[model samples]
Target chain A: MAEVKTVQECASMVADGASVMVGGFLGVGAPLQMIDQLVANGTKELTLISVVGSYPGGGFDIGKLTAGKQVKKFIGAHIGTDPALVSGYNTGEIDVEFNPMGTFIERIRAAGAGLGAVVTPVGIGTEVEENASKQSFYGKDYLVFPPLGADFAIIKAKKADHYGNLCYDGTSMNTNTTMATAGKVVIAEVDEIVEVGTLAPNEIGTPGIFVDYIVKGFSTDERKAIFGEIWQKGNKLK
Target chain B: MNSREIIARRIAQEFNDGEVVNLGFGMPTMAANYIPNGINVILQTENGGLRFGGAPKAGEQNPDLGNAGGEPITMLPGGSAFDLAFSFCIIRGGHVDATVLGALEVDQNGNIANWKIPGKFVPGMGGGMDLLVGAKKVVAALAHTDKAGNSKVLKSCTLPLSAAGVVKRIITDKAVFNVSSKGLELIEIAPGLTEADVKAATEADYQVATNVKTMTF
Candidate 1:
């Protein structure tokens, strides 16, 4: 029973201090229309949970929000691609909580699956071990990472049904599938929305039950235009 | 030959056939080009690609298929794409046979520090920590000294450590060292470089092997 809404209408549901999970690796998979709406709404003091920062160079994708100083804190694995974020962190304008890439997603997956914690050796004997609790199982030490859930998850997908079943294409599926379930209010932005029973069962990356709302985002042609715009802007530096 | 290329060529000799390997950014990425033609090694990009070919030409680039560094690459004959979860599972589940990475500092105890530098505002630890702790064999490729002529090989790391006591082999412009229970052991020195030059440049105490040879590749 997922509702279809405009990006502005869905973005209005977010409060000033809400914790948000933005799915994408840099810019490719970001829900740009929804993100633009959030920026236009002037949402402030948000806690952002993402896998990586915006694409290299600023003034596009999540870099727009970061440049606007809307995010108060960022929780992610890598933020190197965004200079604004680095400047924010250096100036104490933004607080950053860094996690190893695997542990970050695993924690989100743990929240989605209702699991207690993630125990693995990915961060053992390193700086990441400082915050984790150590336990010995199977004669090896593992750092236990806690689950990470958010107030909202803004995700991008290739297609979806009216029932909100999602299907992703190519690398865009990186973090969107897991973040869809880890948020209390999941908003999926897709290129096209079909009727119920349109998407086959095996093709769906995330089931409809996990999606609370669906918003029509940029079509493929529009996406290509936007990419061209951004790429051209980046090429000016070269 | 440039120092980076020489180091990359030297480390490329370590790859065994039928092994799954991951190369980190910077110097380690160069090893992909030097991998022997018939080695049959599979390259894994942490951004969710495996069995991928080397970097693609400018016009041949596919936007959807790129490495973790966002460089365009080609998919080999047996290449496959999985999500980030499956890619990391391959890393953390001990399926990656060897991982070559860059290092900022390495110590006699074989501890590595590469991800962060205090007051420098680094983006975040992307995959270095996980790769260091998870891979079956960890090989570090780096310059022997920092830009300021400071020794990068030290008695103990001064910067934040990425992982502790995990490095097994190190190939630098000056020489190659092996980490053992006894600490850093110099097994090979670069051509025209003597054991004394290595000792003078290195801050960490290391044992010179009884029969050290000049680097070949």
Candidate 2:
């Protein structure tokens, strides 16, 4: 079972320089309320681990944090989507770490699953090789990446039971499920909160055990408006 | 057809029935429209969709189920949506048959440089490196030359490399070459192009195939 809290209450728990994992590919599965609260609270110098880059529009999704300079370092795949992130990185205002998409998620999973490290051939001879050690097994060299764990994970879900079992809709489940496991404290921002028995066993994407707190998120109409604004600008390719 | 379309058509022919193919963000996404009529290939989007259809017409966008580029897309009958973890599992676990991607530069050694530009706002490598490392065959599709009329096929890439020696084949606006251990082998040229024209346009040293001929669209 999980405690139900306000977005402000959840955001208040985070401290300066804390490492946070944000779930989303762009802004699809990001915790909208929590991110908004974090910005409103004026949190600073935090580290963010996420997938891909920021959302399509400026001051939207992770872009708000990037624009506010709330994030000191960003560890994820892709950063070209946001102009603020680009300028920040180019001017050395913010530190940036790049990871191959698959490796990024796997590293989070490794931390969640209590594994020591992840070994894969994704970056054998590239600059990714510089950060990780190379281990050759069975005549092929593989890069061994250390696991990544966060102090808090902020994620969005379609629905949540009072006990914190989550359900997601469509591809919006991108990084939420994985980040749910990797965070020391997991806060779920959900569109709907139903009774505990409402979510069937198979329908729950993330079980209650992994979730610590839940907050009501944008209503259907509000969410649709937000999605429209962000995705309409997603016309250009990166 | 335009040069990009021509390149896409040629790469589409490489598909086998039921093959699971991953297309990179830009030019490679165009290949989705040209899959051989009779082939039944499953398309995987790293953003969390499998068997997804091509870009949706205007006013048909669905925010919840977009591609890596955040464009609206549809799914085939048996297609399913999963999380990023599972989508990447199919990619990094060596299940994708082929991956088609665009490149900023590709060298004689088949190394590619498409991920980032030095001193530029790096859009971080999204999924190109994992696709190159895991796919059974990697094909790069792009214009043969840059805007300044410089050859994109090179002896060595000056831009930052995406992966070292990962390209298996390259289909450009001008030619198709197979990257082998020896070097690039010129196997097909565009219509109205001469061997001399290819040689002049290409900076990399390539062996002209004995069976070289104009590509049929």
Candidate 3:
């Protein structure tokens, strides 16, 4: 059985300058309480990897890390949503590495699946091909992207079994399930923890064998309030 | 109709009944609202939801449900969600029937540049390259000219390419075109406009289709 841990304990596991893969598309399925704990812990010089910069209009979710100057670098697919990230990129405060969304996730999948690299024709004739090495099979050209793994992966899930198997709600399973396999240490944050048998085999979005620790996250009401507050703060509600 | 709505409606006609279409964010997303009646077009967002419903009816938002653009939405009856890898399988594996996206520039050869403007706007190309390459038919929906009144359909795009020679059709407020081996073909012009107007507005070289007609919808 996976030992249940505290948010503070999980936050302390992430060292300064550590590479952390956070699972979320903007704010959806983000480990919000864990992110807040990281900020409150004053962790700095971190490499933040995810799918997008943050929520649109910014100043919430991962955007808070950029605001606190905690993220030294950002590796993801989109940066246009968060003004904090864009401003940091322009001022030379944060280094940004851009990748196509699918390719980005595929590289992470490669890492988790124990593959050496990923080759695809996705970036064939664009500037995305500039950084990757090109290889040819027959007559078609494909770009080779190396696997990307992180020191720790913070994943959010709707429910978890005592053994750390996770069940996701809706589209919340963006990069969480994939990042779970790629991280050296994977910590799952969940709203509720159930007995191992409670989560059916089909309900297990991410298997427990890959998960190291489990932490309790905010309840549905708390998460709802947080989203409302963030959107209001970002003027999406106001 | 306004330019954006007109462009959206025109592009909406490109999708036929029982077709799955991926709608990119911003202007291209507007095409969903204008989809022609009785045409059952399925909308897919690469962030991992498909067949999205209108905004939540109760106005109670669920934190987990949203589209690629980060806008809150609901899945329609028979809608489904999947993991990121599976989502991209539907995207990068040529399962998407058609994909509609806004183009920053469309060159004479049907190439598009929509991801970056270098220092000004550098949103990472999010699933655009895969969509263009994997979709059976790729549609470029945008205004005929830019905000500063420069032609967006140009001789060649100065910006970096999102995907090479992938655009199958171009829909704009002023005209509709089909990309072919010989380059852009003007198939429909806006009502009250003539070939001269399209030629004046477009910087790229094009051929006039013999069956050209005025846009009705």
Candidate 4:
């Protein structure tokens, strides 16, 4: 059984200079309260990894951390959404590493699965190949990428059982499922927490064995309003 | 219809029945509204979820059922959601039949430069590289020219490329082009536009197809 911790408690475990993986596409599936708590705690000089750079609009979700200058380095697939991160990157305040989103997630999965490396053809003919090692298989070229793991994984899900098993609401499962396995300390922030056996096995997105702690971040209504606010605030791409 | 809508409508005609397609941001996403009535095009949102329907009404939005760009959508009868890695596998593993994306530039050699610009801030390439390299076909959908009346079909792209020699076709507001070993082949021009008009707006050297037709929306 997994112990349910407060967002503060779990966030406190993330020390300064630690490497953290945040699961989200833009701001979807992000552990909002936990991120806010980390920002509030003034965690600094952190290595942050995310999928879409974070919420398109400024100072929301993981964008807050970037804006707060808590992150010293960012590894992400897209940074165009957040103006602060963009300026920070352009001005050299934050070091940013770019990868195609598929390679980013697959590298994390490789770490958790104990794979040494994965060779992919995605970056073969582009500047994305500049940093990686190259190899050929079956008469084709591919870039070899090692695994990327983090000290902490912070993710958001719709629901969780006492045992830390998680259920993602839908597309919110994006990077959250993979990061759960790659983080040395996996913390899941969910909207609801239920008793064990309340969540069926097949429906479980991330098994309890991979999750180290569960944090109830919001109620269903609260999450709804949060999403509504995101739309109302013009943070959406559409 | 406006040029963007027209471009999207034209791109919609490229899909065959039951083929899985992924749409990129901006103009490429609008193609969803124009898929032919008889065609059942499956949508693959890169974050997760497959074979989904179009967006919901503003008040009907479901946060969990949104695309990679955060637009709300509906899952069809056989639609299913998977985790991040598997969703990418469907993309990187070549299950996607076609991917339509907006290109900043398409060169004479059919390469696309979409993710980055010279000194401007832009989003990083999310799944573009994998989609370009893995999908069976890649379609570049954009306007024929930039806002300043400059041609985007170039002798060579000045910006960074998303991938080299991956775009199979180029659909713009002015024309439809088939990318080939012999460079861009002008196959279809927009209604009210002529072959000479396409040539004047294009910087890349290309040949007109023998059977050139006006694009049908």
DockQ of each: 0.44, 0.58, 0.63, 0.60
Which candidate do you rate higher for TM-score, 1 or 4? 4
Each candidate's TM vs. the true structure? 0.93, 0.95, 0.97, 0.96
| Lowest summed lDDT window (length 10), candidate 1 chain B | B57-66
Model 3 misplacement above 4 A: A228-238
lDDT string for model 1 (A145-204, tens) is 899999999998888898899987656677888899899999999989998888889889
Put down candidate 1 lDDT per residue, B1-217, tens digits, no spaces: 8899989998888899999999998878877778888997888988777888765543444444456764445788978876677778888878999999998889999898888888874867897787888899999888999888889999999988888899999889998999988999999999999999999899998999998999986
Of all native A–B interface contacts, model 3 reproduces a fraction of 0.66
Q: Per-residue alpha-carbon lDDT of model 4 for A1-238, expressed as tens digits?
A: 6789999899999999999999877677889899999999999999999987766676888889988999899997888888888988888898989989889999999999999997899887788889698988999889999899999999889999998999987688999999999999999999999999899898899999999999989787777677776775664424
RMSD for each of the candidates: 2.4, 2.1, 1.6, 1.8
After superposing candidate 2 on the true structure, give the runs of residues whose Cα lies further than 4 Å from its correct spot: A233-238, B55-62
Q: What ranking emerges by DockQ with the best candidate at the front?
A: 3, 4, 2, 1
Report the C-alpha lDDT of model 3 over A108-141, residue by residue, as the tens digit.
Answer: 9999998999888898899988879999988999
Residue A193 error, candidate 4, Å? 2.0
User: Which tens-of-lDDT digit does each residue in B83-182 have in candidate 4?
Assistant: 7799889998999999999988998897999898756746788888889998999999988999999999999998889999998999999999999898
Q: List residue ranges in candidate 4 displaced over 4 A.
A: A235-238, B55-60
lDDT of each: 0.85, 0.86, 0.88, 0.87
